[model samples]
Target: MDIVPLLDRIGEPQAAALFGLITGLIFGIAAQRSSFCLRASVVEFAHGRLGSRMAVWLLAFSTAVVWTQMAELSGMMRAEDARMMAVPGSISGAVVGGLLFGAGMVMARGCSGRLLVLAATGNMRSVVSGLVFAVVAQMALQGWLAPVRNWIAGLWITPGGTNFNLLTSLHLPQQSGFVIGLAFALAALWLARKNRVSLRVLFTASGVGFAVAAGWVLTYSLSQVAFDPVQVESATFTGPSANTLMFFLTSSPVLEFDIGLVPGVFLGAFLSAAWGRELKLQGFEGAGSMSRALIGAAFMGMGGMLAGGCAIGAGVTGGSIFVGTAWLALFCMWIGGMATSWLLDQRGAVAQPGLHVPH
Candidate 1:
């Protein structure tokens, strides 16, 4: 009984697709249950309520950082293999793109990953945003926006002219970087809990964070078993989102479903939602709201393309590794988000303007 042959028969692409579907479902269900939203987290923080979502994001970052570094140290992966750490990296592009992405997320009310989860949970606005995000991301990746992004990327200056993580660039070792980064994360968690931390908030945040970290560990590590030549990497959402959309379109050419992290997130979310009886279909109320979602999606696509990652990619995964570009992107994303939120507030776009009619 050669089970290895049977497993191999299933193939990689199919595994990836199945992974994506499962990932989407898990992401949808968890997000729906905990109200896990990146935009909402930032908004709440901005408004002085930061005990729940922010903690979860921080915990996820901390867990990913520790796990990724351990993977590197254990010969399972290499930091240099990540796209954000590549030579000739686009520093300017990351900042500019992050700003745009941040702004767009605010306008659209969620990041691309968040939008997918929301869509699965019957948020029609999110579905519109996800569709728009996919279309514009594809366009930006291979259409009119490509040249512009390239031009901006060309302006980056690596003064030291070396390929190194931020810690190394500052004359620190990998171990020191790990320790310092972990310390910072712990400090943030401490501060978040310093003033009236609730156990519910802590549990939800920690659980979600662990789930996200587990997601990366499982998919990347498992995939590497089949593709032994490649290094395993984890905890990215943007490029995968765009790639999944393309895969959906070009399914005829590639017919294998490989279980990847994003797909796992979807599956996990979906199952979680189904178990809780929360799955439903919903649509946008009107053209105006739909238009806003579309615009937000386009911005997210363009910005994520330029920046080379999204909230999860740059903000948590790479950022935790102390990747300089990731930090730049994260800062710009925060700024862009804050700016967009302010603009939206100015326009009084807080509440749904009309009645909620079922679709």
Candidate 2:
């Protein structure tokens, strides 16, 4: 789908936004229907639910890996040419940020992507978390907290760094990286086979992976369009969340894919919720829930920026490309999530009468 002529015909910004909208809409629908929440996946695993939803996450991520590689192999898109691949990054930032983001996701009850879907489905808690996540992400990116973020990021930033992944570090062929990614994905599928999985979970996860891969292909095509300054990237919710917020605050006519994608998620979720009769107004349980949400959202926003992406962005999309930072972020996120689950258990035990807290 050569988009150069399309850009020439309908204009670059419109074309990009349209493509983003289509992908985002599909993502939102799949997510809404499948209950695809990374945070939940982690929590369930910690609680011994095993491969049920976790399988969904794995399948989606694996699907993305396969599709993204296909695009690269077919000359439709090159992962190495993406901005995240070109820019210098911090390993410390990825580790620390992922931990923070993971902990926050547990407290907030969802990641930024899940919040967006919930918000569209009339979840007030999600609305608050989504807004806070966007605002804090903006702060970490270039707002009041930017200096702090930069300082921490600079601590581990490597100039002209290579070997951020096993394949690159080992000096192996790129095909080796593809194999590693597929192997992990396959392992996830195998684990998921232990439980009775639903068709909705399978289909939704596959769609999500496809949506992510499509985002890459679409953005790459837009980058090839003449006279347009489209960034070669895929769906990363954290930065895009901030971008969506900024679009409304400023008076610029910059119709970016990010902006279109954000709203597209909401619209798609709204439609799915309506169709499924799942649209219902919900709010925080009390002051405690609200307070937890505030802290969680703040952490997620800052952490996501520091880590370079959120679950979908870095974990699924970036991980699919076999990047070093994405792998570290994913590992640390699991650790952070597990730790938070333990803490939550302790806190719950403490709150109960005649309950003895474990050492």
Candidate 3:
């Protein structure tokens, strides 16, 4: 959709926020209904099964990859200009941050995006954890933790500096993205069918992916037509969560994409849950669970900032575009998640004993 006329009317910031709201709403509903979560997928993998949860994650991820590549091929978006690519990335940060974020996901029983979705569905445990996640994320971004994040991030740089691309590093053709995305889609389909994931689940999971792709394309499209420059980006909760928190705290807050995105996701998730009669007030099973979740949220807040994105942010959003550091981060996340699952899940209620995973 050409947004030039709309840009003239509502201005760039407002337009971006509007788009973010729409993108987030789609993502929230799809994720809420489909239970698209990387943490559960990793746990399933650790348990030696590609079950329904794993299938949902795979479907959402592959669908994002496929659609993103298609958009690039159609000239609707240019992934090369996205911050994940344009800005120099850190190898060390990806490794360390991914490990922390993954382990925290296990402890928290959800990743940042999943936590927000659960919170919207009236999970009090998630609400507390989510708020903590936001505060820590803000700290990591600009507070005392910023120096630490910066130091770690400076430890290792991407091989080719700012213009790095995984596919390019591998000497692959431009069309290879489409080919690779198609392959991912096929594998995801195989997993879905094997796991007997319902059609409804499959469809909603695909919606999540589509929203991610739309975020990239729509934002890029806006940047092309707008009088002022805008960042081309896609869905990610870490920074957005922090920004949203500050938006409410400050008297004269700036209008931006992240500001609208968080509330939009919450509203969308809440609406879907309420409509489906799935909204229920839930709290921590015990003090152990609450403390564990809060600690996990703290880890995720710092780790996500250091790593450059959260699970959905780096794994699905950036990975779809074949960003070098993003893929590395995603790979490390899986390794960390699998390791944590093996250690915690194998203990049979060892990780937060009475803590119940929200459905």
Whole-model lDDT values for every prediction: 0.65, 0.84, 0.89
lDDT of predicted model 2: 0.84
Q: What are the runs in model 3 whose C-alpha is more than 4 Å off?
A: 346-359
Candidate 1 deviant stretches above 4 angstroms? 1-33, 157-163, 191-204, 207-232, 255-262, 285-287, 349-359
lDDT of 2 by residue, 1-359 (tens): 77767877889888878887988998999889878889988888787666677888888888888888878878888776777776776788898999999999989989899999999999999999999999999999989999988888778875575425546677988676557657867776686667767767788877888888899899888887648466777777999999989989998857878888999889988998999999999999999999998899998999999888998888888887777888788887888887897798788887886776443
Pairs that collide in candidate 2 are 164-324
**With candidate 2 superimposed using the best TM-score fit, by how many Å does residue 350's alpha carbon deviate from the native?**
0.9
TM-score of 2: 0.94
Provide the TM-score for each candidate, comma-separated.
0.80, 0.94, 0.95
Query: What is the clash count for each candidate, in the order shown?
Result: 40, 1, 0
Cα error, residue 197 of model 1, in Å, equals 5.9
lDDT tens digits by residue: candidate 1, 210-316: 44444444445445565533323344566676666776778454432223555566666666667778888877767876777788888999898888778877777
Off by over 4 Å in 2: 161-166, 353-359
- Model 3 over residues 1-359: C-alpha lDDT tens digits? 67778888888999889989999999999999998899999988887887888878888998899999999989999988897788899999899999999988888999999999999999999999999999999999999899999999999987656837888889999899878877877888888899888899999999999999999998899888877778889999999999999998999988877877788889889999998999999999998889989998998998899889999999999998998888888988888888877776556556567964322
Give the candidate order by descending lDDT: 3, 2, 1
Q: Which whole-number lDDT from 0 to 100 does residue 99 have in model 3?
A: 92
Candidate 3 residue 83 Cα shift, in angstroms, is 1.4
Superposed on all Cα atoms, the candidates' RMSDs to the truth, in angstroms, are 5.4, 2.0, 2.9
Candidate no. 3 TM-score: 0.95
